[model samples]
Structures are given as structure tokens and as C-alpha cells.
Target: MGPVPWTVNSEIYPEAYRGLCGGMSATVNWISNLIVAQSFLSIAEATGAGPAFMILVGVAVVAFIFVAVFVPETKGLSFEEVERIWQERPQRNRGVAAVPDQKEPLL
Candidate 1:
């Protein structure tokens, strides 16, 4: 859950910004890894493993909510289509970003 948003960030960014997003995603992953590696033992020591793990579980729940509420569905949409959806203002748009339900290219 901690890293899931970063993975989605890597996947959904438009091509022009994909490289920048990729670097950001990589940075997030590495930073997360470093934090967990450096702090897990201390966290476990300060609070028993049970508590530490529980904290993590709580974090996962929060992350899930954050993703669900804030992240747009991009699984089946093309980058160009997705970009259009996001670039247009909701007030001016009557529909959901013109996002399609396309599963795959017919070709």
C-alpha cells in the first residue's frame, strides 16, 4: 500500500512527463525502502512488533482510501485519452473525462 501510489504514478503519467514521474517514483520507492530499513528495528524496539505492525496496517488502510478517492482509473485508457480527461475542467465537461471503457485495441 505504501508503494502502490508510486507504482500508479509511474504508470499513469503522460509521456512528456513520464520520465520525470519515473524518477519521482523511483525516488519514492528508494526513500520508502530506506526509511523502513533504517527505522523498523527502532520502531519495533520503541513499540513492540505487534504495535508496529498494527501501525503499518493502519497506514495501509489510509493509503487505500487515499488512492481510491484521489487516483483516477487508468487501467484501460490510453495516455492521450487520459490526458484529455485530466486536462479538461470538470465544470466545463459534462461527462467523465471522455474516458473510454476500452479493454484493448481491436487491431
Candidate 2:
């Protein structure tokens, strides 16, 4: 809904792969926007407004969880530091809890 996605996309990838990853992320973002915009009316009509809104809320919750777990915090960190944080993390522990000096993920 804001610049968070763009800002994160800019900071997260290595310089060499930034362009490719940024384009991919942008494509996915627009596709998701299109899907929701196109389907909201049909979904609401088919299921009623309360249920339709609830479905969107459920999706938002899932997305929040996914971001909290998988997205690294780049605040106050240099590009190399961000990369290092991700690289130092174990595959099994990619969540915010595993991030250095952070006990809780930003919400």
C-alpha cells in the first residue's frame, strides 16, 4: 500500500542481481493487485460482503506472517550488513527471531 515494498526491494538484493529481482518483484506486485481488484466484486457477490472481507483479512494475516518470518530487517544496516545477516542465517531459521540483535520482528 506504500513505499515499503519498493524500499525493501531496493535494499535487499545484491547489486548484480538487483535489476532482475526488482523487475520480478514489481511484476508479482502488479499481478497481485490486478487479481485482487478483478476478483473482489465477484467474490463479494458470490459470498456476501462479510465473508468476502473476512477472506481478505485472512490473506492479510498470512502475508503479514510470511513477511515477518522471511523478510530481513534492513533498518540501520548497510547493504553488506544486510547481505551478511541473510547469509549468516541457517536455512531452517530464516525468521526474525534468528536475526542478530533482534528479539522481535517489526509489525
Candidate 3:
């Protein structure tokens, strides 16, 4: 959690748009935090803590599934390599670690 967003933001964007994307990502992250913090107590009060937490858990599960399906494995890849992967791979193949005919170890 601590490093994941920063790492993904850095690796996912092209050099020309990295700053813009990073700023947007940070803005979204902070806004999301604000929303949850502001709503948690009210949600808990309306539906006990257990149900409130379960709602959060449900959201987290959906987020996990989205990432698993959409985010590419960027480990050991350079900025150019990462950009190339996104450009060359189809949407369905984006999440795969091993690209066809590529020797690069992507984990």
C-alpha cells in the first residue's frame, strides 16, 4: 500500500505525461481518502461497524480484481519497455507477465 501507488504511477506513464498522470493519481488518491474518512463514522452509525467494514471489504475486493485484470506486470521493465508493452499488447493480454517471443522476465 505504501509504495504501490507511487511505483505504479512512475512506471505506468510515458515520460512526456508522467508528471501530469502522477498529479492526477495523487489527487484522486487524496480525494478517495477524504471521502472514506468523512463517511466512515456516518456509515458505521447507520449500519453497525461490522457491516460498514464489510462494505469497505467489498470495495477492496472489486479494486483487487480490477487491478489484477488491467494492470501490467512492470517489474524489471524500463520506461520505454513499459510503454512498448502497452502499445503492442492487446487489452486482454495486458496483465500477462510473459509476452509471446519475449525473453524478458516480467514479474
Candidate 4:
């Protein structure tokens, strides 16, 4: 669920920025997971496990709402269609090429 936006963004953003954005998104996700894990014991102790769990649930709800309102349906759309839509934006034109030879080949 969370990876959807990052995947779309990575596909539509400039090639040069894709890796950075993906890495940042991944790092933030991991960090958030770690924080939640590390904080769970303290949160459960201070505020009760119920409240801590509710907080996590609330975050998920908020994320769902945001996606529902802002994210478009990508279902059934081919990759080319997706790229065509993204290419409409001037800034994204370079990033939305039909063939993305963005990443360097491994030597």
C-alpha cells in the first residue's frame, strides 16, 4: 500500500532523482518502523498498549484517506499509458520516456 506512491513517483520523476527519492522513502519507512518498535514498550508502559495501538491505527487511516483523495486509479493502465500521462507535465517530460534507460548497467 505504502509503496504505491513511491513506485509511481519513481517512474514519473527525473531519472537522476528516482534513486534518491526511492532511497529516502525506503529509509524513512525503515526508520519509522524502528521508531515504532522501539517506542512500543515505552508507549505501552506510559499510555497503555491500547492507546499506542490506536495511534498506529490512526496513522494508517490517515494514510488511506490521503491516498483515496489524491491518488488516481492506475489499475488496467499499461506502463506506456502511465508514462504518457506523466509526460504531460513539462518537468516530468524527461523522466517519462517510453524506454527508461535511467539506471546504469552493472559492470
Compared with the true structure, what per-residue lDDT tens digits does model 1 show for residues 1-107?
55675668755777888888878878877887788789888999999999988987887798789889867888788878787766764545555656655789766
Comparing 3 and 4 on lDDT, the stronger one: 3
Task: State which candidate, 2 or 3, has the greater lDDT.
Answer: 3
Sorted on lDDT, highest at the top, how do the candidates line up?
Answer: 3, 2, 1, 4
RMSD to true structure for each model, in Å: 11.5, 9.1, 9.3, 10.0
TM-score of each: 0.73, 0.77, 0.79, 0.61
lDDT of 2 by residue, 1-107 (tens): 33546877879887778899888888888888899999999999999999999998998888889889888888888989887776677644655564465688878
Which numbered prediction scores highest in lDDT against the true structure? 3
Query: What's the lDDT for candidate 1?
Result: 0.77
Q: Flag clash pairs in model 3.
A: none
TM-score of 1: 0.73
Q: Residue 50 deviation, candidate 4, in Å?
A: 1.1
Best by TM-score: 3
Task: List the global CA lDDT of all models.
Answer: 0.77, 0.81, 0.84, 0.72
Candidate 2 has a TM-score of 0.77
Model 3 agreement with the true structure over 37-56: per-residue lDDT tens digits: 99999999999999999999
Which tens-of-lDDT digit does each residue in 1-107 have in candidate 4?
Answer: 45765666645545657778778777887787788889889988999989988988998899889878755566777656666665665466557777666488757
Q: TM-score winner between 2 and 3, please give it.
A: 3
